[model samples]
Target: MDKKIVFITGVSRGIGLEIAKCFSNNGYFVLGTSRSDFDLAKVLSSDECLHIQLNVTDRNQISACLDQLKEIDKVPNVLINNAGITKDQLFLRMKNEDWDDVIETNLTSVFNMSKLFIKSMVKERSGSIINISSVAGLMGNAGQVNYSASKAGLGGFTRALAKEVAARNITVNCIAPGFIETDMTDHFQDKDLENILNQIPANKMGNPQHIADLALFLASSKGNYITGQTISVDGGLFMS
Candidate 1:
């Protein structure tokens, strides 16, 4: 049987890396991308697993990458929009560049990638798009107005796109992770980490695999009926 293909962004490390491992383990051909170079030999030696350079924010780069994929006949059955940036600041103190960067990287990139690939998916009548959002998107967080707005916009984008593609048998969903133990959260001061842990019913941060497992399910046939949903894997930090 031909291996299924999954295209994932921001896969140099962290949640994106874990997602690539999950799909690769499940016999999917993972086309993982990152802005920086990475050593894929550490995790996947399979010829099927491809590591590509991509700046999701750049439309030209996205087009070129997709064109290359098409040349290799590696159009993906699944697309994961996992590349995002945080320019966190209080709205009053946030710079215009910070807000613009976050929105473009986190939100607009989703639209650019989705728009490019969705045409093929529509024609094929099968595909899954899983967006990696954040719990901050669901419940607003202080000092992250720009981040929150970007993710919240992603949720709405997921819903609207799901409706548009449902008839074509394409599913669009968002996975909003909360307080996952990644490099992104490693900079949290001890006191800040303690305060965050206190709010979670699980009393701990989530594992990146927690989000990966859910993403795998959503990308697989098991999740055919699920679409237009923001599934939170936050260890009970925000229940919704």
Candidate 2:
């Protein structure tokens, strides 16, 4: 069998970076994309890893990425729609541009990215797609209306797409992370952090590795049977 290739978006740092490193350490060729350029070798010494500058919200960039992959003869077996952004604002105060930007980056980008790869996947009759969502999408948050709605839409996208490609051996799934200790949360004050921690039953904040490990499982053959479902990894903060 050819060596497996994994394509990850927004992989410069945080959970996406961890997932790339995990896959590389496990013998998968990594093709990671970010809006800004990043040196993949800085974190891992894998010759098989390639980092591409991609703006997921741009259709031209997505097409160019597909063309480049085809030229390189890299058929990605796993596609992780991990690129997303948050525009936090109260509903009444939120700007229209904020909602549009959040929706385009977080949700519409998934549609474009998935469409770019699903054809080759269907031709091969095998693939795995993992979406990185947020717990805000599940239980909702006070000031992240746009962010939450985008993530919530991912659930519907995952289920419908899963059914469409199930017969073709492709699986689509969503992962919602809660209060992970990433740069996204680094801006919180100590008091704010303390308040957030109290809500989590784990008492400690979750790490990027926690999300990465689960993403690995879902992308690998281990999670072949799991599809059209949203799994939360929030230290038991929001239990359904």
TM-score, prediction 2: 0.97
* Residue 172 in model 1: lDDT: 100
Least well predicted 10-residue stretch by lDDT in candidate 2? 1-10
Query: Compared with the true structure, what per-residue lDDT tens digits does model 1 show for residues 1-240?
Result: 133899999998899999998888888989998998887656776677888888889899989998899999998979999999998788899999999999999999999989878998988899999999999999999999999999999999999999999998899999999999999888999999999999999999998999999999998788989999999998888875
Question: How high is each candidate's TM-score?
Answer: 0.96, 0.97
User: What are the clashing pairs of model 2?
Assistant: none
lDDT of 1 at 50: 82
Show where candidate 2 strays beyond 4 Å: 1-3
Candidate 1 residues lying further than 4 Å off, grouped into runs, are 1-3
Cα lDDT for residue 69, candidate 2: 91
Give the clashing pairs for model 1.
none
lDDT of each: 0.91, 0.91
